[model samples]
Target: MAMIELPDDKPVRHPEYVYMDYARHLSGRLRRTITGPMWHGPSLREALDGINAADAVERPIRSMQTIWEIVLHVTARAERARLRMDGLALDEPTPEEDWPRIPIPCTAAAWEYSQAQMATAYRSMAVRVCEVMSSGFLKVVEKQSYNIATMSDGVAEHGAYHAGQIVLLRKEIHSRRPNGAHVTDLLW
Candidate 1:
């Protein structure tokens, strides 16, 4: 079969080549930053690994956000990005929405649940990215200036940024403990 020719006179390879390359790059980023093995440092999951509900809600550093709030905030951003990529409408995050409030008495189970929810949200967004790429819908949407690829990169970077914060918070929390235990020791 004759290959498709672009305006630049370059013969197009299989559609899979174009789509798969984009999909793999985006998904790999999501995986590495959110849950997969990290080359640079701990993945998001690792950063939050052993945080109990108490530690998650503790503000050891004055005026800084708790791990619980950060987790929810990150999850919300990932979900919103996925919605945008799906061509769905999304409202701007209100101040209250950006940094979520933890329950009055955050329990271990509640923290665990939030972590699970964040994982699910991240996975959902990654899957949507791959779907968009595989379907060859790579052009910028009419409603937005950036394309799905750009959004994917933003999500990965956003997650990584918050992951670093969680790691720092975990260290601070552990340091405040009498036992001086490491964060990894608390992992379930």
Candidate 2:
């Protein structure tokens, strides 16, 4: 059989309708998924609403990550994306750097700091995205398997995906409360 050689350059994936303000679009999405009054339900920040440091650190099941760990993970990923957008040319994060270690003696202050850190990372990434959008995908998209546009979309998707996990975790925690309190009993 004869072997066929593939071309080095793959086809570009510019969308049919160009986004004039794509930066703002993705940035708003990032914000909504992070903290919201989203139409479907609570955002990531909303999911964590009223949860204290103890609850953030509480592992409902031995196998699952604590909310605090999840927050740090999300923040790290966002920061990674921002760095890449900023032209750092980073590869994937190492396994040890994947999920950050939650600090010992986790206090209310630490929890708040984690949340704030998450917000700052997202905001910074979002601002960098504006520059990417303004610059367009011509030269940029070629370098990466996934371009800025797709990566931005992934960020939004990732946040919402984790937000759902946080929601389920909350229900599990609430269900196990001493009084048998149910998250199902109330709107979270």
Best of the candidates, TM-score: 1
Clashes of 2: 0
* TM-scores of all candidate predictions against the true structure: 0.84, 0.82
Model 1: number of clashes?
Answer: 0
Query: 1-188, model 1: which lDDT tens digit per residue?
Result: 33788899989787767777778778888877777677676788989887888888788888788899999998888888888887775667798877777866688778888898888888888788878885545767446677788878888899988888888889888878898966474551
> Which candidate comes out best when scored by lDDT?
1
Q: Candidate 2 regions off by >4 Å?
A: 1-17, 137-143, 182-185
Question: What lDDT would candidate 1 get against the real structure?
Answer: 0.80
Model 2 scores what on Cα lDDT? 0.77
Per-residue alpha-carbon lDDT of model 2 for 1-188, expressed as tens digits?
22334486555434422443566778788778776757777788888876789888889978889999999999988888777777777767897677989987798999999999988887777777766665663235334788887887788788778887888788887787889765443785
Backbone N/Cα/C clashes per model: 0, 0
Pairs that clash in candidate 2: none
